[model samples]
Target: MENLKHKARKPLALSTIFLRYFMLLCGGMLLWLGLLIGTYLIATATGEILPANYVEKQIAAAKDILVSSPEIRPDQIPSLSDYALYTQEGQYVSGSLNREQAQKAWKAVASGSKGGIRGYYTVIQREQQQEVLLLSYSIVMNYRSEWLRTHLPNPELLGIILIVTGLLLQIALWSYLFGKKLAKKMKGLQSVIGKIQNQDLEFTVQSSGVHEIDTVLDSLDTMKNELKASLRQQWEEQQARREQISALAHDIKTPLTIIRGNAELLSETAQDEIQRDYNRYILTSSAQIERYARELIEISKTQEGLKLERVTIDTASLLEDIEELLRAAAVEKEIQVHMNAHNMPDFIAIDKDLFQRAILNVVMNAVEHTPIQGNITLTAEGKSDSVCFTVDDSGGGFTFADLREATKQFYMGDRSRSSGNHHGMGLYITQSIMLRHGGQLVLGNDEVLGGAKVTLEFPLS
Candidate 1:
């Protein structure tokens, strides 16, 4: 049972909950409306019957008086001054009758003397022993007033019904509008979440014209953006670490190879002078280790973020400097290093030191990859928006995968074919420097030289 309960899923949305509550409220309002109308009808019916019962009570009281005083003369009866007075013509009269006139009128009616006509009459009689007057009276009941009471609702009850109905309608309308706005906001948020799930972290939720919903959406958007930024930073850091490890391995391999070769030579020999040779071999290995450490430190400092000192660097002079630096290495390999320029601009905006390092790295890479007697050509050309430096070699070209991963740190195509000093950090650092200068590095197969081509394109400004 616990497992099953755990497996039970949460509701997909809160909309259903809101809908349930809204429906309940609407139902309650409808019930109230019904009750209001029912109460109005009941009150109207009771209101109509109240006046008739009051008139019946008054008639009964008059009959009691007549029965108690049978000796009263026709002109000496008790007056109904508290009741509404009317004339014989059924119009409102000026004044009410006195007790004597009331008694006279009642006695005349009991003695069968017709005085004035009335409508809807009821009579109560009493017996007497002596020759006495039997008092009677007529009342003209207003049937129009009674009919109105029977058919029409009381004003207060009607007003209550209108107020309640109006309130219910307002509640329903407001709920409908709020629900629509809520649904729209929810849909927008759902779309944003869907995009986020698909790893598209660039979208934002649109406002839904509701303050609370918009505020929530804004907060979610901010959180998603922060998460995306953090993840991207972590990924970049991981990539950097992997590259560092690969570069470290590459840097250590050369000394290890030389050490192993010298050890093998010493093992085959059986002379006392072999110790001196082994000592020299160990010293050489130590030197290589020192060089590797220094190079690693320089690489680390560059990657840690070097502040650029901007200067206008002459492209032609920079190319000459690179040529002078690589000439010795090229002479050792018997490779020809050629530098050429056509329509080259004299100066470009750059940090002279960083730009020189970037250019020298590419040239060194070309020289290292090219075999003996191969040609390494360096060319510079200025276009409208950018200046391009191209290095073309006549060595074996890179594979498709190598070309794709060329700028990645410690991504070497063939270690044996590369120069012993090759640590695969040259191109990676070159690419990073180019990016800092608002430039790019392009790697492809050199169609003309049948070797690798590396182009560094820098913005003209």
Candidate 2:
């Protein structure tokens, strides 16, 4: 008990399963933040330097060309297409420049300003004259390139991509690792419960490393083993009882035959009328006893389950035979027996003897319950996937208990409803035979006949 208590308390210990997962989540967030910050910093630095470096390179190249030669003349200077040279009097010189552009460049240079029109510029004294030089470059390239560079996956956008990618990758990795650690055990439990719901207990339950789960699985395994053993023991006992019944029935048959034969002989040899009646009673009782013995033997065989020997038979012929066989009994009782087939198949596959016996049992049960001058109807009809055999008797209908337990073995109703000769296995044996043929027996009160209604339904193969 102490050990069990300790086991139960194990899960409540200061365990780190949740803590570990929480830490993994925190680490993933940290990684996403780190990647985002790093990407943003790098992209921002590059964004700043790229356009500045491009403009600086262009300015440096132009400066190198102008200052590298010592004897260069203003008229013979190389063309600076991007720059507009201007005199201190606002006149354009040594470069391609429109009048307005030249005036704008000269104004900035002559006013001793540092900036130029449309772009940056510088003013310098000429090498041999007091005339100042105005140098300007177009602002279009620098502004357009800088806008494109900053906007085509800019720093903010790159940072967002990096963070999203990092988070997604981390989530995938964490989910895979977590599932590997626990999902397998949960899946095993799910499979076991699913099979149990289906009433399948054949598979083995393995232990999960978790104490609580392993305990539950162990308990389930133990329960399954106990149930299996119990069922086996019950099956063995039922088989042994069937064997004893079969042996007893076999042992009684010879003596019953002798008694029947002796009674028959005595009926012929008897002189007085009373002696003949006594002999007749002996023969009748002997026949009933023999029938009981036969039924007992059949019960034993039926309990062992049925092996069918199938034959093709038609519904019309089958019904006709039943009517003809029971015609004498009905005539003796002054009862009306009717057998009919409607929309029944011409041919059906069934174990002819067993099927006939099952039908006869139900019909005879009705016949016994019915009063003289009453009506008994046996019906056969074919359905979509099966055929139905029904018997109705114009007698007292079944009670609720009869409807519930009529087909159970050795079940008898009240003395008023039950026959003294009945051993109560007729409907039970009939139902068992019907089940063997993949069919069923249904019992209900027949309103039309004012009696019991028994239906035997057979599957069409």
Candidate 3:
């Protein structure tokens, strides 16, 4: 019984079951109506089959009583068989018995005042061969109450059973549907999560058409995209750092080897001049070591967020100082050093130390790359909005693509111009400094000089 209750509660298709029950209710009402009509018709036909003589005698006696008195009232009638009537003016008038009233009177006559099954009858009266005769018949009301009481189940019990069954069916159907849909959505989420757990970032979950579930999946997708981007950026940074370290090691190795060879030569030599030359070589090697260490420390500082301390510095004095420092190196390479500044402002806001370092690095790069007798021009052009500095070196020009990625940390062009220690951070730091000062660093092949050109644009005060 419990299982049956569960089944009823969980009917397979709700729409189909409701339609069936509705049809059953309509058919039951139609059948009940048909039974009522049939019972009424049968009762009427049975009344017609009753003896006519009985109805006639009762009707004649009622008519005679009504006629004998000029005034006849319903209450003063002599017999149950007599009929009475009242006029419209409230006077007593004579009347014959009607079908309905005679039916009640005949029940009293036949059952001695105990009504005959509480129904209607008819009476027919006639005077034949000087003898009065009556014919009476009755039509008992159809006892539908008795039929229902005997055959039908208790109405309250039946109603409760139907209600319980319907509720159980609906609950079962909804539960199954909910469980199935939930499982489907959960499975999809599980698959996506499993792929993510396995480090498969490319997997995407299909939307299940459920709003809440789809919203969660969309959020997961967004998180995955962000994670992928972060990982990719980290990987690129790691690769750049690795290349920088390798270049650093290579640059230090050559100087260390030279220093070691010079030390050994100094130990083996006895001549004063040879000893002196060895000492100079040792001094040069030591200076190179110190330079490398300083460069490494500067790079570390830059990486750790070096901030510029602004000060008013004379642009002309700054240019003069840089030219004096680089003149001997340019002379050795037979490179012409030209410092051209026309209409230059006297003072500009700058970090005197870091800005000098950044600019010197770019000048040194130009000097190292230019050939003998190459012209290296450093020009500063002052505009209303900004100050532009251009360093054009007469050397082999770079490709279009190489200019774009030249400022990237540790990025070197495919064509090697110098065998010297080049970590490729000089231009990168120059670009960084320019950006920090609300300016930009641009690089291209010089249109006229046919060499590399670097331009730094700084905002005016």
Candidate 4:
């Protein structure tokens, strides 16, 4: 609150900048207006307009022209707008003015009116003759040649145009200057935001030359630094934990192998049936523990992504191994396991251990869901550019929820199909393996078996 109060007490510099620009605009226009008026005054003072005696002076000068040419043609008269010779009866002889304009001028001369046909006029007389000389001229200020006078606009209208055009130009100039300043500051902010959006947080945030935008940039920079540190720390911890679990699982394998070997030897030397049963129990339990340890190590590897070691193996041999392992898994349930290994590639490239494990996972899942005496079919064949292995079990088919989410990690299906022992990692592991081998896992209900059908497709090339 103290900082806020101190900052608030300071006057806004942005407002000062705006006020300065506004004042400059007003002063500039005033200066331009004054310049126009001053230039016009200087020109006008230098005999731009004739004095009041100009009409009387022109009349006195025209007496000689009237004596020399009684009938003055328009072209014969010099230094006048128009000229005409008229009798005492007001008849036009020759002049630049039309008959109507001449009559209007004649009326003004006869009645001594103050106004005539839109210009100044004067008349000259010779006392011995009945002829009269009438001359007409515009009373406006003169400048430029006759062509320019006829073509150019009047001074007042031209001044108004210049002032309006200058005002518009000033408005555009000031707007560009103000917008360019604001855009410069905004561009700095946009650059920082763009870097953050592109996931590139390694940059130095600079001032935007504005208090408000700089405030935002400060906060954003703080957030970026904090987020980067948090991500680095999180990644380090996760990596350490995974490494520890993998090493622990690997360490357990050796002792577990020793325990299972001792149990197997004791079972072979059993003298009583009860002792044999106890030996069998120890062997079975140890085997389960060993399998769990192996899966734990593999799962840790899979959690990131799996890497495959492809080796050339006979397709028939691979299928026979899968069939034997799957049959052993379903022995307790008394399920009939059948294998169809026809029309397959003789030798195919595959990761032997990983591929067998993926096949085992799918079949083990089927065994768990299938009832006793149920039949499980295994099909192996090549189609197009891929080798496909499909497992179908004679049991209840997969529900819609299972179809959609069975392969997702930790997604245990409905209790009716999953039972109590199933942990929902079988299909997930199989899918990860398939993906590593550039393949895909497909799930559906088999029409013939009337149970879940799982197909694993591995690319041949």
Per-structure clash totals for the candidates: 5, 0, 20, 0
Rank order (by lDDT, best first): 4, 2, 1, 3
Give the lowest summed-lDDT range of ten residues in model 1.
Answer: 1-10
Write the residue-wise lDDT of candidate 1 on 1-461 in tens digits: 11111213432235655666678677767777787668656755665323323444555566556556644343334332122222333232212444555454554455666552222234333345222222233342222254554565644555566877777776877678767856865787678778878888876466544445455667777878798999999989976875675477566767777776776676566757747554554554455455445555555646565456678877667777666656654766889888888877888888876776787688777877788899998888889889898989998878887787877866776676765676567788788888888899998878899998999998987
For model 2, the superposed segments whose C-alpha errors exceed 4 Å read 1-15, 35-153, 194-205, 229-237, 240-255, 266-304, 310-321, 324-352, 371-374, 379-389, 399-405, 408-424, 435-442, 457-461
The per-prediction CA RMSD against the true structure, in angstroms, equals 16.5, 8.8, 17.3, 7.4
Among all candidates shown, the one with the greatest TM-score: 4
Q: Using Cα atoms with residue i matched to residue i, what is each candidate's TM-score against the true structure?
A: 0.46, 0.59, 0.45, 0.62
Worst 10 residues of 3 by lDDT: 1-10
What would the TM-score be for candidate 2 when compared with the true structure?
0.59
RMSD of 1: 16.5
* Prediction 3 TM-score vs. true: 0.45
> How does model 2 fare in lDDT?
0.69
Model 1 residue 44 lDDT score: 50
What ranking of all candidate models by TM-score puts the best one first?
Answer: 4, 2, 1, 3
Q: Show pairs that collide, candidate 4.
A: none
Query: Could you give candidate 2's per-residue lDDT for residues 1-461 as a string of tens digits?
Result: 11122332344211455468768978878977976667546655665423333444555565645544443355533222245554556566655556777777777766777777645775555554435555564332222245655566634455577777877887788778877877765676677678777768788775554566666666767766677788789889878878876897798889888888888777667369757755765675566557657767886887545567889887678777667545644665788988778788889999876776787678778878899899988888889999998888998978888888889866888777767766677899799889888999999878888898999998898
Pairwise TM-score winner, candidates 1 and 3? 1
Evaluate residue 204 in candidate 1 and report its C-alpha lDDT on the 0 to 100 scale: 46
Task: Estimate, for each residue in 1-461, the C-alpha lDDT of model 4 and write its tens digit.
Answer: 11121233433356666787788889889988999889778866775433335445655775586666645555545453576667878887657778888888898999987565647776766444576777787555445346645676656666789999989998888878988987886886798789888979888776655667667777788878888999899889877767776898898889988998898777777369757755665676577667667767886778745667899998778876787678777878999989887678889999887888788789888998899999999999888799899999998979999999999966888885667765566898799899999999999999998999999998898
